[model samples]
Target chain A: MKEERKKIILILLISIFMLSFCLLPVIYMVIISLSKNPDFLSAEKTLRFTLKNYFDVLSVRSLHFTDYLKNSIAVSTISAALSVFIAALAAYSITRLNLPGKVILLFFVLVVSMFPQISLVGWLFKLMAELGWINTYPALILPYIGWILPLSLWILVSYFSQLPKELDKQALIDGCSRWQILFKVLFPVALPGLFSTFLLAFIFAFNEFMFALMLTADHKARTIPVGIALFQGLHGEIPWGNIMSAATIATLPVIILTIVFQKRIVQGLTRGAVKG
Target chain B: MLPKGTEKSKELIEAYSFISPLLLFILLFIFVPVVGTIVTSWFKATTFLSEKFIFFENYRLLFKDVNFWQSAQFTFLFILVSVPIELFLGILFALVLNCTIPLRGLLRVCVLIPWAIPAAISARIWELIYNYNYGLLNFLFMKLGIIPKPINWLGTSLGAFFSLIIADVWKTTSFVAIILLAGLQVIPEELYAQAQVDRADFLQRFYRVTLPLLKPAIIVVLLFRTIDALRVFDLIYVITSGGPGGTTTSLSLYAYKYFVGGDFGYGSALSVILFLIAFFMSIVYVKLAGFSKEIA
Candidate 1:
């Protein structure tokens, strides 16, 4: 009983530490966003709560905060959907279609994933410039799809491999083409895996910074991260409240997705990183 | 019924067709850019200047450049300092989360919150938290009497370095924990029960059973975190902008500055150097982790 009590106390203490360590900055962000004075923690001032920061951030047309949000949503959604569909095809081939050099291909993709973004951004900048596609959605979306493919492929491959080979055999015997087996038969059963991959890929594409920073010239193609990063006050003073509010809003979609699909995200992340 | 050789070849063609789109995207976007960077490094490829072939000149300049060396040094030190701390905290969090604790799901969601948010956005939040007068860290430290006055977190070199470290840790420890938690879950309960039967205490069990069993996962986390840390850009870019005398500029950011300035040759050269380092580290990782063998 004493030992169990000690263990319980230990677990509770660590849990508290984990919660505070993970949450305090996020809480601080929200607090500053809501406060009229960002310097409320100073000796004389206190938190004077208001919704002005959020109102200014959202309603102010010049800020282009909503435009950034819209671009981010559109870019990330398209990139994630296309990346997953393409990776599913490749993964289907690797797992079921007896593709030659499939192992080599997987390793190649893994190596590509580790290549630093700096290595690619310079040339991509020139390419986008030459194509006259700078500050456009396609400029960001195409690279994002490529960047996201490896993780999607890895996760889906693992998920697909786990499903019995007999499913493919049965589908093949039904006079189904390879394409039909993948789309009509396999996809229905792998819906959860597909959703998980889509979620992870969407988060990745949404959070991507270097690509968006280099590819997009302005708010027309700029996503939220770049937008929030470059958010400056019209005057010299840093608009803490407005920046925090924008950040808070920007984080909402990903935060909600993560919390709701916490288990699926964890599974997909582990499958991509560790299972190999 | 066995298919004929031509039929087998036809299936191969079909399989290749399925994989072609993915291959094409990666080849164009990733592979071509990488090769282009490599090729451009051998030239005087500035925006205003005429492109001229100047093989190895940029690299020679890089060798003699002070800022390049400083950024390289900072990048290495940042990796050395931050990766170990993240690994340690990640293990602790993973161990806690692995236990049958109350609010386990809530604890997980809290952990995932940091990892979920973009580093660029979170660094802005950290920027506020590390503010001189009204920041959370300074205010708390002063109230607790840990320091006499608010330190300029992003103003001094050491302050900026550690500031970036703290923010990076906060943003990434969740990832390490998640990866390690997957590892911890795969650990058999029987081993712990057996350890208990052998009269092993908690610490003993962790050292003897858990550590040994979790080696592969630990290795995976270490490699992933190290490679990721080596390319540290977004957090430092936002928080300090490599300020306080460029003390915290990573190789990636340093190269990015050149790219922004339209000096693609030097930028590509810098990128090539970073790519080589990362590539070398990955080779070591592949060998150490035996990834190929495991997948096969």
Candidate 2:
């Protein structure tokens, strides 16, 4: 009985350690975000709290916090939607139709996915400049879609392949056209896969920083990650309070999306990774 | 849906139509840029705007560049140190998470929270933690009487390097844990039970049964992580900006600087080298995983 009790205590201690290790930075950010004093140490000693930093970050004219938030949302959502649509069409054609070189094509996707964006960004910058797309939504959105399409394709292809083939036969016998069967039959049944792919893509695009940073010059197209990283205080001071508040706000959407779609996200991510 | 009597050309056309949008985008955005990087690496830029075909000069310059060599060396050192540490921590966490415990679901979610947040944001949060004056580390250390003065975590070369690793490990170790946990679930309980029937202890059974089975998963995690770590940029860019006298600049960061300097030729060469390293590493991982499978 004593041995069992000791084992339980040890496990509990380790669990607590792991939990704190994972959560302390975020907890610290939250504390600093809500503190009245900019100095976290001072604030901890005093035990005072306020929401002023949040308000200031949102309302300050030069901060451009709202613009950053809007740009992040718009770029993430549109790119995710575009990637899902384009990738789903390709996945369907590969898995359902009699396409040649499917393996080579999938391999191509994997290789391209692994290609570092640092190499690609130079040419991308030149292209966007030629098209006069600097500081425009398409500049960032196009690259994001291209970057994330492989992941979405892999997830949707695996999901689609697992689906029963009998449904397709039935739809064909029902005299539905190819597009009709795809749009009306397979799509509705594949909503969960589609939804999961969308979530994963959205989170990735939202989290992407390098392309957003390099591609955009002003607040017009800057994302939350780049904006929050580059957040400047008047007179070139680092405003810890406002920075923490903005960081907290920047993280909220991805966190909430993750929690809400936890299972599907895990499944989509792992299924592609392990199986591939 | 193409009808039972459809010609092969018609079916091929249908498939082509379905795949054209993504194929076109990838060809334009991904493939073209890759080819461009390779081609541009062979040329020399006379000015920022003009270039000349100077085969092998960029590669030669990159090979001789002291900063590029240092960045490459540091990147390898970072990977060699960090990946193993991450794997060890990940396995421990996965082992704990695999056990039947209270609040298991909640713990899993909490562990994921770190990985879910963007690296840029996480780096910023850690920057606060590492602040010399009013940071959490300094405060906690001072409270515990560990040091007379607070340590400047990102203000020294050694401190900055390890600080970047700590932030990265914190953000990414959970992903490794998750992948390993998925691998753990596939491990049948009967193997453990069988080992127990022979009066084997926990460690003995772990060595005898668990490690061998988890090899493939470990390889997958290692490959993904090593490649990802090799190309790490934003974390370093945000945390130290490769500072403390340029001690933490990674290969990607080095490439990015040249890209920003309008020296596209050298930047492309640097990135090409980075890609080659990652590609070779993946091949090594694949061979290792395959060899282990044969032994098993």
Candidate 3:
């Protein structure tokens, strides 16, 4: 009994230690947010909690987080919807269609999926510049679709392929066209797969920093990630409180989405990863 | 008039049609641009857009560039430092979680919280924690009487490296853990139970049973992580931006600098080298994951 008690204490201590390492950083951010000491630069010691930073960050006339939030939502939703649809179509074709070069194309998608966003940022920047698309939603939306297509396709392909081929063939035998069969039969079955991939892709695009940083110079096209990064108060030093507030607020969408579709999203990501 | 066994051609065409939309965009965005990047690497670009072809001078100059070498070395070092350590932590955690315990679900949720939090956001969070004044690390050090003064966590090379590693390990260790956990789930519990009946102790059972079963999962996690870590960008970009005078400038950041800074030729050469290096290492890991199955 004494040995068992010792074992239990050891486990409790180690788990607490591990949890502290994980928890402290975020907890510290919250602490910094509430503290009134703006002179964190000077390294002073005064602890006062105030609502001033939250108000400043939230006020439309001040930080305009409300407008930025609206824009981010608009871009993220539209891009996510369009990208998922395109990826679904592509994935179906790759998995179900007995087309030429399927192996080669699948391989191609794998290789392309690994292409760093930085590579395209340079040329895409130039492309957008020439197309008069600087500071435009389409500039971001189109590339986001292109960028995320591989992940979506890969996920849906694995899920779609796992679906019994007989379901497809049976629908075809019932005088249904291939496209109709896809919409009515396979689509419903693969809905979870599609939804999960979309969530994954959307979160990534939403959280994306580099392209949003380079391509969008103005609030019209700015994402929350970029907006939060370039937060300036017409002063030199960064406002830790406001930055923390914004950072906290920015993660809400991802958190909400994760809750809404947590089951499918986690499964989809793990499944997608396993296939590769 | 088609010959018998022409069903192969027929099926192939259908496959092409199915994959056409994905293929079309891939060609336009990925394949073409990659080819352009490669071709563009050979050119003497007085301009970012100027296509006039040059010789191997770009590659020649790339080898001589000290910044390139420094960044490459640092990038490689970062992967070397972080990957094995994180993998070990991941496996250890996974092993703990694999045991039938009360509140396993709660612990699993706890494990995921760190990885789920954005790396950049968490890095900022840690920066606050690593503050020379009232920072957790410094405060703890002071309490322990380890140091008389707060060490500048982000102001020095080794300090920044350790900080960055902590953040990376915090944010990504869960990813490895999840994968290993999957492998652990796939393991037969019977094996452990049987070994216990044979009077095996913890160490003996672990070595005789658990570890051999963990091999495939470990390899999978290792391969995935090595690739991901090799392409380390956002975490580094957010926290340090290869700071403390380029001490942490990774290969990806180096590639980003040259490529976006309009030294496309040099950047392309570097990116190609980066791709080759990552690809080679990925192949090594895949093989290490027991390619004997494939051979058989």
Candidate 4:
């Protein structure tokens, strides 16, 4: 009984210590997000609840919340859809096909995707300027594909390899061409991978800041994360309440995605274990 | 059945055909850009550099750049400081979860929240937290009587770097925890059962069984953290823009400053250096992990 009590006590203490920083800090952000005045930051009083931030941010004409959300939704959705489609098709081909230099191709994809985004930001910045592609969706979209391609490829390829190969053979025997076989047989088998990759890609694209910050100069191309950052430096003093609400609103999609995909999260965790 | 000889050729062609489009995209996008980077590193090129090669001046200038050196030093310091702390925290957390703990899954996911957000977004969030005026950090410090005044966190070098470190630790320790936890799970329970059976203490079982089994995962976790940490930017850039005297300028950020400031040649050279550093560190990690002997 004593030993069990000690174990429980230790676990609770460790959890509280861990929570105080990692999770509590985030919770603190939420609290700040909900508070009315900036002065509440210094308030020691408990449960000083206010909905003013939420009301102000959710107001469409108020602080560009509507604009930011729209851009984030449009850009992230398109990016995700395009990436998953491209990645799935590619992953299917890489796995199902016995292409020449396939081994070399796979290795190259791994290195390319892992190529630090910060490394390419310069070259990309220069290229975008030269091509007059600055502040455009293509600027962010193209890079997003390059960034997420390797992982999507890795996941779909691994999953595709494990699938029953006879499904493809049967499709071929039944007079289906290669494209038909991939679209009909292999692609369907790769649904879980497709779903998860979509969510992952969307979150990544939405959360991207550096490229968005540099490439896009205005709200037209700006997504929520970049928009939220810029909101701080704009229009006299910082709009702390609106910034918090915008961040909270921006964070909602991912939180929902997390809850929905909690089942596959474990599988993704183990399979995509950090690759060197 | 189809004849064997013709069938093999057809199979090979079909495979090539299937993967060719994807291959072409990879080549045009990834391969061309990387090659462009290398070519630019050798040539004195601007954004509009459709001109001649000036081999190694970029390399020469980069070699003597003082700010570049400071950035490199700061980057190395950031990694060396942050990676071990994150690892120690990660392993410690993993040990807790790996043991018989209640609400394990709930706790595990909570740890992943910081990681799940983009570094850029999280950096901005931390900016609010670190804001000198109307910032929670200063508010707490004042209440606790830790300081006489609100410290200018994002306004100073040490302040920015420490805040960045705190954010990163919050963001990524879960990555280490999950990886280490996976490693922890693989140690046969019977070993622990027998250890307990033989009257071994918690510390002994961990030191004897867990640590040795955890070596490879720990090495990989260290590699991941160190590589990412050395390239730190989004946070610093968004928060301070590497300001208050460029104290927060990382090697990658310096490379970026030159590149965006339109010194493509010098930026590319710096990039080449960063790549080499990452490659070298990864090789050291692989060697320690004992994955080297298996390499071709």
Candidate 5:
């Protein structure tokens, strides 16, 4: 009983530490966003709550916060949906069809995923410039599809492999073509896997920085990460209140997705990174 | 039913078509660009200057550049310092998380929040927290009497390095934890029960059973974190911008500077070097993990 009590206390203490460690910066961001002055933590200042920061971040036209947010959502959505679809088809081929060198293809894709983004950005910049696609949605979206495809492929392949071959055989006996069997049969059964893959891919695409930084020149294609990173004041000083509010707004979608689909996200992550 | 030869050929054609779109995207965007970067590195590619062939010149110049060496050193040190700490904290969190604790779901959601949000955004928060005058660190330290004055977190070489490390660890430890937790979950309960029956204590069971079982997962996290850390651009780019006389400039940021300056030749060379380092690490990881056997 004493040992069990000690163990419980230890776990509780670690849990508290973990919570505070993970949450303090986020909490500070929210508090600063709400405060009238970002210097509220200093001795000379006191906390004065206000919604004006959020108001300005949303309404101020010059800041172009809304434009960046909209672009991020659209680009991430398209990229995630497209990549997940492509990955699903490829996964179906690898898992169901008689694809040669399946292991080699998977391993090659894994290595491709590990290639540093910087190594690709220089030529991509020149290529986009040549194609006159810089500062457009396609500039970001196309690379994002390629960038996110490997993980999506890996996760879906694992998920699809678990499923019984009888399902495919049954659909084949029902006179469905390969495409129909995939779209009509496999997709419905793999909806949860597909959804989680989409979620992770969306987060990956949305959180992307280097490519978005290089490819997008302005709010026309700039995502939230780049926007928040480059948020500045009209004058010489840093506008902490506005930046924090923008960050808070930026983090909401991902946070909500994380909290609500926590289990699905965990499952997808492990499946991608660990075979077990 | 098994297909006849003609039908088998048709099935093969269909499978190739299914995977073609993926192959096309990856080849065009990832493979071709990496090749382009390598080819460009052997030239004098720049915006203002006319493009010219200058094989090995950019790399030769890189070998003699002081800033390049500084950034390369910083990148290596960052990986060495950060990956281990992240792994340690991650294991602790994973162990706590894996236990039958109350509010486990909430704890997990909290942990995932850090990993979920963009590192660039989180670095902005860290930048504010490290502020000298009104930043949370200064305020808290002063209140607790931990220091007599505010430390310039991002204004000095050592200070900026540690600041980036702390922020990177905060953003990534959750990722490491989650991966390690997956490893922890797979450990059979029967082994622990047997250990307990043999008069083992908690720490003893961990050392004898858990550590050995978790080795592969630990190695996976190690290599993953190392490769990710090797390309440490976003956090440092946001927080310090490699300040204090370029003390914290990562290899990626260094290469980015050259690119921004229209020195694509040198920039591509720098990136190629980073790519090779990461490539070498991934090769080591693949061999160590024995992924071939797993996939087979």
Candidate 6:
């Protein structure tokens, strides 16, 4: 009985430790963002809390906080939607149709997805510059779609494979053509899978920084992560309050979406990885 | 119900039509740039001069570059130190979360939060956490009598490296745990039951049964994390910018410097080396996991 009790106590303690480790840095960010002092390190003795930092960051004209947010949304949303759309067609073909070289196609997608953005960013910059598309939405969107489509395809393929084939047979017997069966039958059935894949792609594009940093030159096209990282002084004095506040706001949408769709994302992740 | 010959040909055409859009985009964007990196590495070209292809010269120059060696060494060191630590912590958390714990759902949700936030944002939070004077770390250390003077976390060589590692571990260990947890959940209870019947303890069961069963997941996570650690860029860029006299500059950051400085040939050579490392690691991972059959 004593040993069992001890085991339980140990488990509880470890759980508490892990929980705190996962959460403390984020909590500290929130605290520092709200703290009255602009310099977080100097305000230890009598800490004051206020929302002035939030107001200051949101109101700054040069920071372009809203512009960063708008651009981030536009880039992530369009790329995610396009990647998912393209991936859905490919995935349906790979999973349902009897196509030659299907296995090689899946393997190719897997391999391509692993290429680091650094490997491609140089040529990408030169190409974009040549095309006069630098700092444009397509500058980021095209690469983002190319990079994210493979993973999205993998997830949707795994999902579409698991769906029962009886539904396809029934639709075919009812005189549905191939396109009609895909659009009217499989697409609706795979909606949940599509939603989850879209969310994952959106998160990946939203968090992408290297490409965003290299391609975007101005506030008109800069995404949130790069914007926040470069949100320092013209004369070299770091603005801790504004930086923290911007980070907090920037991270909010991603966190909410993740928590809300955590189950679907996990399912998609495992279905793609474990089977392969 | 199987289609005859003519119908099968029609279906193949339809499938090709469905896939063509993605195929065209990937070829133009991904495959072209990939080939361009390799092809551009041979030439030392500038906008002012007509391009000249000098074979192996760029690679020869990179072989003599000191910054290249330092960044490569540190990138390898980072993978060596952080991946094992993350794997250990991840398994422990996965074990606990897999058990019947109170507030299990809440803990799972909380753990995923760190990974959900953008890497840049997480680095920002950790930068403040490692602050010297009014930072929480120093305050806690002082209260506990661990040290008298505050440490400048990102201002020194060793301090900056460890700070980057700690920040990375904090943000990414949860991802390892989530993947391992999925592995743990799929493990059959029958094996553990049999071990218990044979009078095996928890540690013994873990060693004898759990480890063997969890090999595939472990291999996959290791591959993903190591490749990711080798290409460490965003965290360093945001937190330290590979500072303190470039003590913490990673391979990617080094390449970025040359690329931005318009030394395209040298930068392409560096990128090519990084690509080779990534390629080697993926081959090893797929071989270990016996994934070739799935493709063939």
Which window of 10 residues has the lowest lDDT sum in candidate 4 chain B?
A: B287-296
Model 5 agreement with the true structure over B1-296: per-residue lDDT tens digits: 55598888999999999999999999999999999999999999989888899999999999999999999999999999999999999999999999987799999999999999899999999999999989999888888999999988899899999999999999999999999999999999999999989988889999999999999999988998999999999999999888889999999999999899999999999999999999988888776776776552
lDDT of 2 by residue, A1-276 (tens): 665477678778878988999999999998889988757483346746999999998998688999999999999999999999999999889888888877768866766777778888877887788799988999999889899998898888889988888888899778787789899989999999999999999989999988998899989999999998887778776888898899898888778877777788778877666655
Residue-wise lDDT of candidate 3 within A54-144, one digit each (tens)?
7777885557676666777888788778778888887777667755555556555655666656556666766788899988998888777
Error of 5 at A154 (Å): 0.3
Specify the poorest-scoring 10-residue window by lDDT in model 5 chain A.
Answer: A37-46
RMSD of each: 1.2, 2.8, 3.4, 3.2, 1.2, 1.9
| lDDT, residue A69, candidate 2 | 94
Better of 4 and 5 by lDDT: 5
Question: lDDT, candidate 4, residue A68?
Answer: 69
State candidate 6's TM-score.
0.96
Q: Candidate 4: deviation at residue B151, Å?
A: 3.1
Please give me the DockQ of candidate 3 compared with the native complex: 0.38
Scored by lDDT, model 6 comes in at: 0.85
| C-alpha positional error of residue B88 in candidate 3 after TM-score superposition, expressed in Å | 1.3
Off by over 4 Å in 4: A1-4, A43-52, A58-63, A166-176, A274-276, B47-52, B145-149, B282-296
**On residues A1-276, what C-alpha lDDT tens digit does candidate 5 reach at each position?**
787788899999999999999999999999999989898877777799999999999999899999999999999999999999999999999999999998889988988889999999999999999999999999999999999999999899999988899998998988999989998889999999999999999999999999999999998989999999999999978999999999999999899999999999999998888762
Model 2 regions lying over 4 Å from their true place: A1-7, A42-47, B1-5, B46-48, B283-296
Off by over 4 Å in 3: A1-11, A38-46, A61-64, B1-14, B46-52, B282-296
Write one digit per residue (lDDT tens) for candidate 1, span B129-155.
Answer: 899988999999999999999889888
Candidate 3 to truth, TM: 0.90
Q: Give the true-structure RMSD of model 2.
A: 2.8
Query: Which TM-score values does chain B get in all models?
Result: 0.97, 0.92, 0.88, 0.90, 0.97, 0.94
Which candidate would rank higher by TM-score, 4 or 6?
A: 6
Give the C-alpha miss distance for residue A1 in model 5, angstroms: 3.6
Give the docking tier of candidate 3: acceptable
Instruction: For candidate 4, give the lDDT of residue B270.
Output: 86
Give the per-residue lDDT digits (tens) of candidate 4, residues B154-217: 7778888888788888888877887888888888989988988887776788898889988878
